[model samples]
Target: MSIETWLAFFVACWLISLSPGAGAVASMASGMNYGFARGYWNALGLQLALVLQIVIVAAGVGALLATSALAFALIKWFGVLYLLYLAIRQWRAPAQTMTLEHRPIGRPLSLVLRGFVINFSNPKAIIFILAVLPQFLDPGRPMLMQYLIMAVTMVAVDLVVMAGYTGLAAKALRLLNSPQQQRLLNRSFGVMFGVAAGLLATVRRV
Candidate 1:
């Protein structure tokens, strides 16, 4: 990729990362419930999921996934159902403050897995990458290098954005000392997740 092309992709990455979706909702929820230090693990897992999607795109399977209505529909429904599950879990979670040692046993792995699953289930991710990443490719340059640059840019942007979401939620939770207030905050996130699911379910392949 040329410097100019890479720059454009970088800008696009910022917008994509900043868009509210299941990943963003999960990041904020984790931060609110797990604290930033622990919440960051989920962010890392989300990066891993992004890596997987990029790989699928780079390998050309993403095109097939995006074009195949059966595959796309299957993954779309899975994402919608999974988001609903997360929404219910968030709504039912007990109100409490988060601390370093306060997480449940094995919660770290659970958080990471949750992040991975949320990202991986979104068929739109692969489709979006397939639709967008190719526009910046330089036929004259090494394709592998171009893919690497794009992947790095995306991961870097998403990491920072997700961290911000997590940190902001963690900070907001600090003032929510009462159970009632925490419960309200939790339900709001749950509602956000439901909205994200609705949006995901309505997505159409381009």
Candidate 2:
């Protein structure tokens, strides 16, 4: 990618990162409940999804998914269900998202995969990548390389932004000391997740 293209890609990505979305919400939730460590894993999961989204966009698989109504809804609703499940988990346990020492003990491979799936289950991510990536590409250039460079830049920026958000949230959550407050906060998060799932379920396919 040329300098101009790089600048544009970065600027757009920066704005998108700042927007409140599933990835940001997840990162913030982790930061609030678990602490910076869980927030970091959450952010990692989010960045991984961005990589997948860009890859799908670059490979032109996006168009196929878009054209197939059944396929799109299947993925979308599946994403919704996954989000609901996550919300339920949050409600039941409300584990501190930053428990580096006493966190839910699991296998390393499974932890990594779980983190990845948490972000990848959102179909809107794939659609967003497909719809937005093409606007930055030039048909005459090496398409793959162009997208590769752009996507990498995007993911890098996103990581930085998410980490910062997580840090701030972790600090804030540390302030609330009461058990009642913690319970309320967990319930609120569950509600937010449910609302998000509802929104996704109701979205009209484009």
Candidate 3:
């Protein structure tokens, strides 16, 4: 890719990372419950999922999945169900001060898996990759190298953006000192998760 092309793709990546979605909700919720240092696991998991999605796109599986109505529907519904489950858990979460000592989000493995599933199951991501990635590709150049560059750019941008979201939420955790305020914050995040799930469910194949 030429410098101009790479620059354009880089800009697109930042814009993509900035777009609000279920992944952002998950990051903020995790950060709200867990401090930024620990909450970072969720961000890491999300970047991993982003890598997988990029690989799927590069391998052409994304095109197949995008074209397959049944497959797309199945994945979409599973993502919606999983987000709804997260919403329920968040709603019922006990009020507690944010502390690295009291980690209620679950084991590191669970948190990572939760983050992975949040993005991996979203068909919209696969579809977006199928639709958008090719626009930045150079057929005459090495496909794998180009894909790698694109993936790295996306992961780097998203990691920074997600960390910022997590940080802000974690900072808010300090101000929510009272039990009532904590409960309200938890419930608000729960509602955001539920709303994201609903938005995912309503996504149409186009």
Top-TM-score structure, candidate number: 3
Candidate 1 wrong stretches, greater than 4 Å: 97-106
lDDT of each: 0.87, 0.73, 0.88
lDDT of each residue in 1-206, candidate 1, tens digit only: 67887788888999999988889999998988877877778888898999999999999999899889999999889989999998988889887654445543337788888899899988989988998999999889898888988998999999999999999987775577577887898899899999999999899877
Model 3, which residues run further than 4 Å from truth? 99-106
Per-residue alpha-carbon lDDT of candidate 2 for residues 1-206, written as tens digits (9 for 90 to 100): 57887788889999988987666666666777667765567777777767887787677887887787887888888878877886887677553433344434434344345457766766677788788888888888899888888878888898898898878877766566665666677777777778778878887767
Output the worst ten-in-a-row residue range by lDDT, candidate 1. Answer: 97-106
Q: Tell me model 2's lDDT, rounded to 2 decimals.
A: 0.73
TM-score of each: 0.94, 0.87, 0.96
Model 2: pairs clashing at backbone N, Cα or C within 3 Å: 33-96, 33-97, 34-96, 34-97, 34-98, 35-98
Model 2 alpha-carbon drift over 4 Å, by segment? 94-115
The predictions' CA RMSDs to the true structure, in order, are 1.7, 2.8, 1.4
Each candidate's clash count: 0, 6, 0
